[model samples]
Target: MIRKVFSDTGALAKAIDGFVPRQPQTDMAIAVDAAIRDQGQLVVEAGTGTGKTYAYLAPVLLSGKKAIISTGSKNLQEQLYHRDLPLMKSALGYTGTTALLKGRVNYLCPERLERQISECHRPDSEPGQLSQLVKIREWSSYTESGDLSECDALAEDSPLIPVVTSTNDNCLGKDCPSYEDCYVVKARRRAMDADVVVVNHHLFLADVAIKETGFGELIPEADVMVFDEAHQLPDIASQYFGQSLSSRQLQDVAKDIHIAYRTELRDTRQLEKVADRLSQAAMDMRLVMGEPGYRGNWRELQTSPSVEKELVRLSDALDLAHDVVKLSLGRSQLLDAAFDRITLFKARLARLKDTSITGYSYWYECTRHHFSLNITPLSVADRFREQMAEQGGAWIFTSATLAVEGDFAHFNHRLGIDAKQQMTLESPFDYPNQARLCVPRHVPETNSFRRANKLAALLGPVIERNQGRCFFLCTSHQMVRELSALFREQLSLPVLMQGEMPKQRLLAEYLSLGNALLVATGAFWEGIDVRGQALSCVIIDKLPFASPDDPLLKARIEDCKLQGGDPFAQVQIPEAVITLKQGVGRLIRDQQDFGALVICDNRLVTRAYGATFLRSLPAIPRTRDLHHIDDFLSGSDTDSNTMQSHLLDQPIEG
Candidate 1:
C-alpha cells in the first residue's frame, strides 16, 4: 500500500504537481509502515532531496492511527503543520485531523496580555510598549490560534514578547479568571482530540520530564512517535533531564513578586523589599562572574571565596522572598504563582549547589546581562530508553546527518537506542555533476594569527567571480565576525552577519539582495534551505569541532576516558564529521541546485582522521585549485569538467 501510494501513477502524482516517483522515498515509506505495524524501533538516514517528510507522512497518514511528529525547531514545526502535512493530506486523500502544538511561550496568553497592557499604562512604562500592546490587543480580538507568530505588528526580538507570554513558572494554570479563554488550554484540548499532532523537540522533552514527575503532559499519548532531525535529541534531552537556574528566570520571579505587591497585595511592604533584594542579588551574581558571552567552570567557581559569598547571598535573598510571598499566598493569585516559582527555584538551586555528583557537567554561561548555572548529565541514554519503554509505541528517528562515516554507533550510544531496523538512503541528486568540492593549496593553519587575512586574500577573487552568492560558514562567533569584516573590506557585495537580525529575516534579506554573501555560524549550518542560484557557494573556515573548553564536551571526554575509550576518535571526530556534513549539505538543497564547496582547513590533508570527514560527504567532484571553483561555477573552462570527472572516479581519502 505504501509503495502504491508513492508510485508514478499513484494518487499523489495525480493530485500533486511536480510529483516524480523516487525510489529512496518509497523504500523509506515501506520501512516506516512496517515499523508502525509491528510497533518496532527504526533509525533512518535519508539524505538531502530524499523527500523524507512525505516518505514518513504518507505512511503515518494512511495507517489510520494516532501519531506525534516532532521536529527540531519551531520553524520546521510550522512548515510541516502549515505547509507539507496539508499538501500530503490533500494529495493522499487522508481525512484525519491534525494540530500544530508549540510551547506555551509561542501562544498569546490573554491573562499575560491583560496584565502587560495594564502595566503599560503606568506613567513609568516604556514609550513604545503601550502602543505595541494596543496593536496586539486589537489583533487578539480576531486571531483564533493566538500564535504570536501571526501578529505582524510585533517584532521578532521585541522585549514585549516575554511580557506577554506565559511560562511554566508564571502561568496561573487553572486558577486564573481567564482560564476559560486561555489559548494554551484550547490548543492542548485540540491536540488531545486530533489524529496527528506536530511539535518541536523542546516541548517533547518537556513532556517527558513533566510526565516523570507524575504531573500532566503537554503532548498527548499516541500509537507512534516520529522524531525528525533526531540528531539533536541527545543534547536537548540532557538539558531537560538536568537542572538549571538562570538570571532571567530569577529576575522574572522577582518582577512578578513586585507586581503582586503593587496590584494584588499593596499592604505587604516586606514583599516589595524582598523582591528588590532578590533582583539585586541575581544581578550581583552576574557581576561577580566577570565578563559576559562565555561559559565558566562552575565546579571550580563554587569554591572561590567571592562566588561562594554571592551564592550564599542569592540563596538568602531567595529564602527571604519565599517567606514573604508565603505569608500572603492565598491573598493573591499572582502571589501564589510567585510562591510556587520561588519554591522551584529554591529546589533547583539546592540541586545545583551539589558539585559532588558524577557524570554531569557543572557549568555556567553569562550573556550580556544574564547568567545561567546548569548541571547537564554526560549521557541521556538510560533516561531516554526508559521513557521509550514507558511510552510503549513505535519509535522512528530520521535525519540527514545521523550516521557518521556510515555508522550509527555514536548516536545510538548517546541515546541508548538499539533499533530493530536501520537504513541509510543516499540522496538522488546528481551530486557529481551538480557540486564541486575544493580544498585549496596553502590553506592556513587553524590557529594562525593571520588566518583571516590570508583566507580573505585567497577566497575574495573566487567569491567576486561568482558574484557573491556565498555563505562563509564558521566554527566560532569570533571567526564569523573576523571573516565578515574582512569580506566587507575586500568585496563589493552586501555582507550580512548572523546576529544582525533574526534568522528568517536574514535569509529574506539575503534573497532580496540577490547577490550577497552571508557569514554565519551555528544555526545557519542546518535547517536552512535556499534552492537555486541565490545560494551558490559555501566556504567553511575550519572543521566544525566543538571547543575543547566547552563544558558538555569536557564532561563527555572525561566519561569516555573513564570507560577506557579513545575520546577523540569515538567522541570528537564523529561529532565533527556530522557537523561538517551538515555545513556541506547546505550547498545543494534541490535536484536542480548547483554549488561549490570550499573547506579551508588543512587538517583534511594533514591529519589521518580527515578521511573520515571526506568519506562522509557526498560524492562531489573534488579539486585543489581556486580557478577551478570559478570555472566550474561559471561553466567557462571545459578542461575543469574533465578534471571533475577524473576526481569523481577517485575514492575520497586523507
Candidate 2:
C-alpha cells in the first residue's frame, strides 16, 4: 500500500508552499506531484519566472518512485548532478540515492590509458604528447569521479575519446580483460540501484536506439521519465535513429593498430600492412569528400565515382583488418587486445554499409579537418511511443514553448501523444501590465537581401528609446554580423557580438556593462535570462524559419511528404513559433521585469500566418507605430485606446 500525501493540485500546492521558499516554484511542484501520483501524461508550458526546476524536482523526490530526468545539454546535466540535486535534497528533507549517467565518452578506460602511455614514448611522437600523457598518469590516480570533464588540458576534438570510450559497436563487454573494472559498466550498475538517474537527451535516445537493436540497455526500469528541455527532442531523436561515420574514426583505428603492434607482434610486417591499408582508406575517404567545405545532402553527392571508389576501399580495408586480427586471436593477452580493436572497426564499417536509409534522410558534413556522413530518420514518433509503452511509465513533457497559439497539435503529433491528455499551463507572470510589444511600421517586405540595412536603420530609434539595455536577436550569423557592425557605428552604446567571447562570459560582460546592446544569433535567443533593467528592450530581425535548403530540414520535409503530410504545417511552422516564443520570452524574466519587444519583420503583420505567432505571445499591450512606442517608453499617456487609434490611422495591410 502506498502512503497518500497530497490529494489534488490545491493540496499539493499548499504542501509545497509550506515547505519550499518560493511561491511559483511551489505551484510547479504541486502540478508535477499531482500528475505523477495519478500516473498521467502531462504537457506543461512554464514561463521563465516560474522556477520550473524545483517545481518538478520536489514532486519527483517525494513520490518515492524511481524517476529519470533527461536534460538537453551536458552543462545542465552537470549542474543538476553536482549543484542542484544536493541542495534540493537537503532543503526538502528527503533522503534518496541519486546517480548521474553520461555517455561512455565521459569516462576513462584503464586499458586504453595504458596503451596511450606506451605510445607517448615513441621517437616520432609529437613534442607535447609525452607531457600530456604524463599529466594523465598523475591525474588518473587522484580522480575519484573518473570523468574526463575535469581534464582542462585535453581538447574536445582530441583522438582520446574513440580510444578510451566504448560505443555499442566497439565494446567487448564481459569478455574484455578489464571488464571487471570498466567505468562505463560500473556507472550503469550504480544507476540501476539508485532511485533517480540524471542523463542527457542524447544518452537517453542512444539507449532507446540500442534497445531497438537488441543490445544491452543503458538505463534501468523507471516508473516515470521527465524530459526537462522537451523542445529539443525531435532533433535529438533524429540523430540517434540515423547512421553516421567519420574520417576521424578511421584515422584513430590506424593509430590504435600501430600502438597495438608495439606490444604484441608475431609479424610486424603484417601489422604495418594493416596500418597502411587503414591510412589509405582514410585518405581515400577525404579525397571523395572533396575540399574541406560544407557538402550538403548525401543523395546529391552519391553519384560521384570518387565516393563509390572510396566506399569499396573502406570495405576492403575492413576485410584486411579482420584477417590480421584473426591471425593473433588467442595468443598473447596483447594480441587479444588487437583482436578486440579490429573486430570493433570491422563491425562499425559493416553497420555503416548495411544501415538502412529507407525511411530517413542522408547527408554528408565536412569541416576543416574531418568528414562525416549522416543519416537521420525523418520521424521517431512511432519509435518513441513504442519505447514509452515498453517502459510502462508516465511522462511529463514541459517547456516554455510547447504550445502554438492555443493548440498543441504540432508538439503532440511529433511526440505521438494522445491529444485528449495534453494540457497547456499559461505563465502566472503578469504580462500586459509589465510588457509592451512594439512592431516598427517602416520595415519593408521586399525579398532583397539588403533588407538587413533597412532593419538596422529601423532598430536605431527603438534602441535609443529603451536606453540601450537591449538584445538584438537575428535569424542567421550573417545578419547578426551585419547588424552588429551597423549598431557599433550608428549607435553610441557599446555593441557586443556573439563570437567575440564565450556565450556565458559575453552575457556576464553585457550585464556588467548595464546599458550595452548585444547582437546575437539563434543560441542566445532561448534558455537565457536577463531580468530587471539589464534587458529592457528586445529587437527580433525576422520571423525564425528553418532553412528549406538545410540538409536535415530537406530530409525531414521529404520524409513528411512521403507520409502524406504537409511538411510546412507539421514541422517548420511549429518549430519557428516555439523558437520565437523563446526569443520574446527573454524580455520579461521576472515579475518586476519590464521591457518592450520590437520585431522588425514585416511578415508578422502582413501575412495571414502572423495571427498564429501573435496568439502564441504574451497578452501584452501591442502597437505597430514608431511614435506610440516612443511615447510609451517616454512615460506619456498611451493606453489601449491610443494603440487602437494609431493602428486605425493606417490601413491594416493583411
Candidate 3:
C-alpha cells in the first residue's frame, strides 16, 4: 500500500505536481509504515530531493495513529502544516484532523493584549507602540488562530512581541481572566483533539524536559513522534534539560509588579519602590557583566568583586519584591503571578550560584542591555534515552546529514539512540553531472587577518559571472558582516545581509530579485530550501568547526579528555563534517539544478581530516581551476568529460 502511494501512478503523483517515483522514497515510506505498526525505533537519513516529506506523510495520514511531527524550525512547521499536509490529505483522501502548534510566544494572549493597551495610555510608552497595539486590536477581532505571524503590522523581532505575548514564566494559565478566550489554550486544545499535531523541536524538547502541568501534555499523548531535521536534536535537548535565568525574565516580573500596583492594587505603594529597585538591580548586573556579546565562564565571573556585589544586590531586590508583593497577593491576580515568579527567581539564582558541580557547562552570555546565566549538562544522552523509554512509542528520526562518512555512530552516541532499524538513502539528484565542487587554487589561509576581504576579492568574479544567484555562507557572524560589506562594494547585483531585514522577507527579496546574493551564518546553514535557478552557487568561507571558546564545547572536550578519549577526533571532526555536508547540500537541490560549490578554506585539501568531509558529501565532480568553474556554470566546459573522470579517480590533494 505504501509502495503504491509513492509509485508513478500513485495518488501522490496525481495530487502533487511533478511528482516522480523514486525507489528511495518508497523504501523510506515502507520503513516508516513498519515502524508505526510495530511501535519501534528507527533512524533514516533521507537526502535532499528524496521526497522525504511525502514519504513520511503518506504513512502517517494512512495509519490512523496519533502522531506528533516536529520540524527544526517554526518556518518549516508552518510550511508542513499549511502547505504539505493539505496536499497529502487530498492525495491520500485521509479524513483525520490536523493542527499546528507552536510555543506560547507565537500566540496572542488576550489578557496581555488588553493589559498592554491599558498601559499604552502612559505618557512614557515607547514611540509607535500604541499604533502597533491598535493594529493588533483591529486584527484580533477576526483572526482565528491568533498567531502573531498572521498580523501583518508586527515584525518578527518587534519589541512589542514580549509586551503582547505570554511566556511560560508570565502565563497565568487557569488563573488568567481570559481563560476561555485564550489563544494558547484554544490552540493546545485543538492539538489535543487532532489526529496529527505538527510542532517544532523546541516545543517537543520543552514538552520532554518541562512537563509543565497543563501545557506539556501534548507530546506524551501521541503514539508516534517523528523528528525531522533530527540532526539538531542533541543541542536543542541540552538547552531544555539545562537551566537558565535571564535579565529579561527579571525585568518582566518587575514590570508586571509595577503594572499590578498601578492598576489592581493601588493601596500597595511599596510595590512601586520594590519593582523599581528590582529593575535597577537587573540593569546594574548587566552593566557589571562588561561588554555585550560576551560568553564568559560563569564560575570565574561570579567571583569578581563587581559581579559579586551586583549578585548580592539582585538577590536582595528579589527578596524585597517578594516581601512587598506577599502583603497584597490576594488582591491582584497579576501580583500573585509576580509573587510566584519572584520565588522561582530566588530558587534559580541559588542554583546558578552553585558552580562546584561537575559535568555541566556553567556559562553566561551578555547582550547589549541584558544577560543570561546558564548551566547546560555536558551530556544529555542518558536523559534523552530515559524520555524515549518513558514516552514508549514509535520514535522516528530523519535528516539529510545525520551520518558522517556513512556511519551514524556520532549521532547515535550523542543522543543515545539504539534504533532497531537504520538506513541512509542517497539523494536522487544527478550530483556528479549537475554540480561542480571547487576549492580555488589561491585561497587565503583560514586564520589570516583581512581574510574576508581576500575571499570576497577571489570569489566576487564567480558570483558576478553567475549573475549573483549565490549564497555566501560563513562560519561566524563577523565574517558574514565583513563579506556582505565587501560584496556590496564589489558586486553590482542585490546583496542581502541576514540582519538587515526579517529572514522570510529577506528570502522573498532574494527570490523576487532573481539575481541576488545572500550572506548569512548559523541559521542559514540548514533547513533553507531554495530550488531551481534562484540559487545556483554556495560559497563557504571556512570549515565550520565549533569555536574552542564555546562553553558547551569546552565542557564536552574536558569530559572527553577525562574519559581518555581524543576530543578533537571524537567530537569536533564529526560535527564539522556534518555541518559542511549541510552547507554543500544547499546546492544541487533538484535533478536539473546545476551549481558550483566553492570552499574558500584550503584546509579541505591540505589537511588529512579533509577526506572525511569529502567522503561524506555528495559525489559532485571536483575541480580546482577557476576556468573549469566558469565553464561549468556557463555550460561551456570543453573539458567537462575529462575533468569528471580525472576528479572522480583522484580528487585534488595537497
Candidate 4:
C-alpha cells in the first residue's frame, strides 16, 4: 500500500488533500486503493459522512484501469458524469476520457421524426397534431445531442419516445435508412471507446440480460466494475428480466395501420373502421387494467373470453395491415411506415406469449395512461455470476449498509460473490456523540398495522418535541396517508405528504419551509439529503420488512428455503437492516448534522432478532425516554453518558 500524508503533492494525493476525511473516509480510501492496486475484490460499508465517492474515485482514477461505475439512479448518474467525475479528474490531474450512456429511448431518431412530420402534414390529419408536428420539425434541425431530454414539449412518459426512438426488439439495425445516423448507436459507440463509462444499474443489467457474447459487443470488458450504490442492483435486475407490453405499442400499431392502408381505401369509410377497432381494443384493455393507475399483478383480474377474442381480432387486423404494407413495400413511404409499425406490434405480442414464468414473475401494469404487461426474473445471482466470471475483473461492491452486524453472507449470496473475500468498514462518524437513537419504550406490536389511531397517538408527542423538521418514513402508502391525517390534526407544524407534489419538488418545498414535517413512504428513506438544520429528526413507523406475499419476495424466499437456508435470516433480515440503515442515515447527512432517530416499531425492543438490527447501526446514544429526547431537542444540557448508559441497560432481545 502507498502510505502518504494528506498533503502529498501528487495527483491522487492532492485530491486526497482537498477531501476532508473523517477517519472512515480516509481509511476506506486506503483500503480501496490497496484492493485495486492488488487486483482483488473488496466490500466496504462506509457510513453517511464518509465521503465514499472520493474514497473510491481516488483509487479508480489513479489505477489507470478502464472502470465502469454503475449508480442506482439517473440522477446519481448525471451527478457523477457531470459533476463528480470532472471534479475528480481535475483534482487528480488525470486526462482520461469518460462518457455517460443512457438507455436508447433517451435519444432521438431522425428517420422516425421525419416520418411523423410527413404524416402530420397530410390533408386528413387534425389541425392540432399538425401544429405540434411542425414544432418538432424546427427542433429536429439543430438539436446536436439528439436527446429528447432537451425538448420541453416532450414528456418523459410520452408515447412519442417509442415512436421516435429505437429499441433492441424493433431497431431496424443496418437495414433502416437512418442506420448510419442513429443517435443511440453513436452514443453506445462512444461508450465502447471511452476509458471510463458511467451508467445506471438498469442499463447495466439490460446489457447483461440481452447481450450474451460475454465479450466485445456494446461495452468493452473493463478491468474493474465498481457498483457505487450497490444496494439497488438486485431490484433493478428484477425489472429488466421482467416482461411487459404497453398499450402505447398497440396504439402506435393502430395509427401506422391507418397510415399504411389509408391510400388503398378510397372510400375513407373502411379506414375509419380499422382505426376504430384498434382504438377500441386498446381502450378495453386500459379499462380492464385501469389506465392512469399503477396496478401490479394482473393475474388477479381475470379477462373474459370476449376480451381474449377481441385481442385475437386486433391481432388479425394487424396482420391484414402488415400484408397491405408488404404489398406496397417498394412503392410509397406511407405503406413503409405502416409495415414497420405492424412488425413491431407483432413482435411485442409474440414476446408476451413467450414470457417465461418458471424463473420469473409476470404482471400487467398501467402508468401515465399507458398499459403494459411486465415480467421479472425471480433471481439474478446466476446471471450476475456469469458476468463476473466472464469479465474476470476486480469488483468492489460498497454501500452504507451492505452487511448486518458485520455479516456479508446475505448480500454476497444474492450477488454471487465469495463471502470469504468480504470486508466491512464501519462509518468513522462519531454517531454516539453527534446522534441519538430513540425507540419509544412501550408500543403494542400485535395490532400495530391495523390500529392506525393508536400508532398516530404515540407519534404525536414525538412530533411535538421535534418541532416539525421530521421525516416520518413509513413502509406503505396506507400508513403514510393515515399518519399524515392524524399528524395534521394534532400537530401545529406544516405537514406535507408524499403524493401532494412530485417527490423532488416536495423535498425542495420541505427544505424551503424550514420547519415543516413531511410524511413519506419508502421513497424518502434513501437517496435523499436534507443537510443543515432543515431535517432534525427521522421517525421510522415500523421495521422495514419486505412483504411476504409479494410475488418477487415470495419467489426469492422459496428459492432460499429450497437451498436449506432460513429465508428470514438469510434474506429478510439483511434486506431490512440495509433499509433501516438508509432511514436512520437520513437524519445525519453531514458532519454538523445532529438529530434523533426514532423507530416507533416496538419489535425492535421486544423481538428476539432485534439485536441484529441494532448492531447494524452506528454506536449512537440511544434512549427510550421521550423526556430525554424532549430535553435534547430543547437544547437542555442533558448528560450524553446517561443516555448511552440507558441504551445499554435495555435488554438485548436476542
Candidate 3's residue-wise lDDT over 1-654, tens digit each? Answer: 998888889898898788889999999999999999999889999999998888899898899999999999998899999999999999899889999999889988889899999998999987788888999999999999999999998888888899998988888989998999988899989998999999999988887888762546777788999999999999999999999999999999999998998888888789999999999999999999988877888998999999999999999999999888898878889888888889999999999999998989999999999999999999999999998898898999999999998899999999989998999999998886788888888889999889988898988999999998999999988898999999999999999998888887888999999999999997788878899999989999989999888887899999999999999888999999889988988887878788888888777777778888888998878877777888888888745475775362365644
Q: How high is the lDDT of residue 127 in model 4? A: 65
TM-score for all models, in order of appearance: 0.97, 0.85, 0.97, 0.86
Q: Which tens-of-lDDT digit does each residue in 1-654 have in candidate 1?
A: 888898988978987888899999999999999999998899999999999999999999999999999999998999999999989899888899999888888889898888878887879988988888999999999999999999999988878889899898889988998999988888888888899999899988987875531123534369899999999998899999888999999999998888878787778799989999999999999999978879878998889899999999999999998888888968989889889999999999999999898989999999999999999989899999988887777999999999987899899999989898999999999887888888887778899987999999999988988999999999989888888999999999899999999999999999999999999999999999999999999999999889999888898999999999999999999999999999999999998898899999877866778888888899887877778888888977545356564352245443
| Model 4: residue 596 alpha-carbon error in angstroms | 1.3
Give candidate 2 regions above 4 Å deviation: 1-31, 151-182, 211-220, 287-295, 331-357, 444-446, 460-469, 484-517, 626-654
Q: Give a tens-digit lDDT track for model 2, residues 246-296.
A: 777666666656666777663666877787788788777877787665657
TM-score for predicted model 1 compared with the true structure: 0.97
Which stretch of 10 consecutive residues in model 4 shows the poorest summed lDDT?
1-10
Which digits, one per residue and each the tens of the lDDT, describe model 4 over residues 1-654?
A: 223423344454565444443456667777777777666777877777667887788788888888888888877888888888997888777788898888877888777677677777788766676666566667777886677877877765565667777555445566677877877777878878888888888888887776621213645568877888798877887776565667777676566556545544444455456666766777676765554645555444435565466567667766665665575575545445556766767776666655444666656666666687766776778877877777776788888878888877777777777622566666656686677788876654735446567767876787777778889898888788988998889888899999878787798899888878899987888889788778887888789998665656776777788889898988888899999998888988877777888887777777778888988888888887767777777768356887866683377432
Candidate 2 or 3, higher lDDT?
A: 3
